[model samples]
Structure formats: C-alpha cells, structure tokens
Target: MDNGSFALMQQLEQLYIDHHSWLSSLLRRKLSNSSDAADLAHDVYLNLIRKGGVPSAENCRRHLTQIAKGMVIDLYRRRRLEAIHLEALREQPEPLVPSEEVRALAVEALSHVDAALRNQPSKARQALLMHKLSGMGHRDIAAELKVSVSSVEKYIASGLRACTPYAVKRRPFR
Candidate 1:
C-alpha cells in the first residue's frame, strides 16, 4: 500500500480498537441496524483519511460520531423516500424496481398497519386505512365514509400517529 493509505489504515485500526463498539451501540439506539453502524464507522474512517486524518483521539471520536449520526439520518430519510415511492408504485400495475431490500420491508410495514386498522371500528379509521392501502384521496375517502374532506384528512393524520411507532418497532418483518 502507499504510505498515506497505510498510515490511514493504521489509524483506522486504532479507531476500531478504541471506539467501534461504542459507535455501533450508539447508532443502534438511535438508528435501525448494526450493519448500518459498522458501515458508517468505516465511512468515518474513510472520511478521516480523505481529510488527512484528525490529530487527536477526542476530535476523531467526535467527528466520527457526528458523521455516523448524519449517515443514520440520511439512511432513515432514504428509507422514508423508498416508502413513499413504494406506495406510489402500487398505483401502477408494475412494481417499482428497488435497489434495496428494505423497500419490501417498507411495504410490509404498511401492510401490518393496514391489518391492524382492519379490526378498528371508527369510520375515521376506515377512511385512513383506505387512503393508506388503496391510495385513495381525501375526497375519495370522504365520499366513501360520507364525511367531509377535512374530516378525512384528520383521520389520516391521526391514524398515522397511531401506526408509525408500531410500524417502526416491528423489524425483520416477513
């Protein structure tokens, strides 16, 4: 390896020894996957090398943590986009081609929430579930529920609040 590359590798080895577990656990608490944490930690090391490597362990740790957190947020945002895209795809007979496996997981999450809402009796719940699973608009749901459009919107918002946390928790979904 080139001298610079070798030096960076050595620094990364030291970083892995010092803070890897801490970084992974921190990421897991705040983010989704341990694999994500490990990948981001490696990215932190790569960024450090690209920036000529930070001098102090304290600075490096802080920098790495910041990068890792940013990566976590970015990943979450991407997943959210994938979910939106997945819903939009269902409008078409053809499926949206997913570059990531998590897209299926996202669809399954929507399915789970839909299944849960099926047992609830509120017309509001039904309206919201129809919008979510069938891609119905507020006006459409309002017509079906015989409610005002604004009421349909409110139902959808409330339903999301009820469902989002539960959806986020059930991981490795089948």
Candidate 2:
C-alpha cells in the first residue's frame, strides 16, 4: 500500500482498538442486546472504513456516536419492517407464505427502498410509492396529491434517482 493508504489503515486500527469496547458498551445500553450491540459496533467500523476517514482523536467519539446512532435507527427500522411483514403473513387466510430465502431477499430490498425514501420529501416519497407500489399513473398520482402531472413526474423521478444507487449496487455482473 501507498503512504496514504497505510496511514489510513493504521489510524483505523488505532481507532478500533481505542473505542470498540466503549462503543459496544454504549450500543449494548441502547439496544439492550449484546449480540446486536456487537454486530452494530462492527458495522460502525465497517462504515468508517468504507467512508475512508481517519477521524481525529478529539472528535472520534462524537463521530462514532453519530454513525452508531444512524445504524441503530436503521436496525430498528428493519426489525419493525420484519414484524409488520410477519404480521401481514399471519393475517392471510392461506397457509402459504414465501420461502425463507425469498422472504429474506424481500426484506432486504424493502429495507434498501425504505432507506432511499427516508431522505426524500414527503410528497416525493408519496408520489413514488403511489406510482410504483400502487401502480398509479403520473396523472392519477397528480390528482391524488393535488399536484400537476409535471410535479408528480418530477417527484417520482427524484425518488427513483435516490434509489438508483442501491439498485445499481445490487445488479448482477454480466
């Protein structure tokens, strides 16, 4: 590795050594589950590595806290979605349910979609959901939202753009 990469790795190693336990303890308190806390602590490091930042010693705790907080929120959202999906399945009259693998994939996709929509404006997210989930046309969405067709189109486009990164990342290799 080059000088910069070496330095970054060294910094990350030190940061992990210094803060992993503290972070894990914090997460344990917040999540009240040791396994989940450990997993999230590892995830926080992975996120930091992916971000390629060598956080300063003085600010590292705060930075790590922010990243961990976001991860915790994401974890909660995923669990909530899973609970809802299970409840819906239970409500169905038929004994049939999706296979475990299929359900896992669906939940993963739903989580990505939920994350993508989290940053969007309410109207934009609603328009996108109406178009994609409800199978509404642009004009129909506009009517429902009390906006023009052009506005609805823009909102859908924006939401799609936000979600495009996740879709692209998951595409199969040729």
Candidate 3:
C-alpha cells in the first residue's frame, strides 16, 4: 500500500481503539440495545474510513459523535418508514395482503418511486400517481389535475422515465 494510505489506516485503527468503547456506551444509552449500539459504533468507523480524512485529535470525539448522530437519525428514519408501510398493509383487506417477499419488493419499489418524485413538480407527481396507482385515464387525470390531457401524458411520461431505472422485473414466485 502507499505510504499515505497506510498512515491513514493506522490513524483509523488508533481512533477505533481509543473511542470504540465510549462510542458504544453512548449509543447503547441512546438506543437501549447493546447489539444495535455495537453495530452502529462499527458503522461510524466504517463511515470515517470511507470518508478518508482523519480528524484532529482534539476534535476526534466531537467528529465521531456527529457521525454517530447522523447514523442514528438514518436508522430511526428507516424504522419509521417500515412502521408506516406495515401500518398501511394492516389496513388492507386480508385477501389483498401480499406475501412477505412481495411486500418487501413493493416497499423497496415505493421508496425508489418516492425518491424519484421528490424533485418533480407536485402536479407531475400527482398525475403520475393517479394514472399508475389509481388507474385513472390520462383524460381523467388531466381533469382532476386541471391540466390538459397532453400535459397529463407528459407528466406521467416524465415520472415513469425517472422511475424506470428502479423498476422491478417480473419473476415467477418461488
């Protein structure tokens, strides 16, 4: 390995050795679970390694804490999203409920769709959802959205193109 890379690795190792236990303790107190705390602590170092800059010794603890806090927020966000998805599933009729695998796929697809729509205009997102999810015709969507039929088509096309990369292909269920 190159000298600089080797030096960075050594610094990271020292940082891990110095702060791991304290970070884990802090995470444990916040998370209320030893295993989750340990995992998150490990992830913090991994993030730092990926980021490739060593903090000054004086600021190391503060830097690590900030990274850990961001990780915790991301973890909480995922958990909250999963809870919301589960609650929505629970509200569906029993016969309409999907298998676990299907549900997972659906949730993943929905996440991608949501992300793709995030930067889109509100009317475009609404038009796309109405057409795809509600099975509304272009003309109906245009009427509902108070736009021209051609505008509805354009919006739907734009949204679909944005999400096309994330589309799940059909496969026979095992």
Residue pairs clashing, model 1: none
TM-score of candidate 2 on Cα atoms, chains taken together: 0.73
Q: Give all candidate RMSDs, comma-separated.
A: 14.8, 6.2, 7.1
Tell me the whole-model lDDT of each prediction, alpha carbons only.
0.71, 0.90, 0.89
Candidate 2 residue pairs in backbone clash: none
Worst 10 residues of 1 by lDDT: 92-101
Q: Model 1, residue 132: displacement in angstroms?
A: 26
For model 1, residues 1-174, the per-residue Cα lDDT tens digits are 999778777877888788878877887777566777677767766766767765477686677778777666656655676677667765755543443565566666656665455445598688776887799988988999998999888888877776776574533535
Q: Write the per-residue lDDT of candidate 2 for residues 1-174, one digit (tens) a residue.
A: 999989999999999999999999999999999999999999999998888997888999999999999999989988999899888877777656666776677678778879889879999999999999899999999999999999998999999999886662444546
Give model 3's TM-score versus the native structure.
0.66
TM-scores, in order shown?
Answer: 0.47, 0.73, 0.66
- Return the number of clashes found in candidate 3: 0
Q: Work out how many backbone clashes candidate 1 has.
A: 0
Superior by TM-score: candidate 1 or candidate 3? 3
Largest TM-score belongs to which candidate? Answer: 2
Off by over 4 Å in 3: 109-164, 167-174
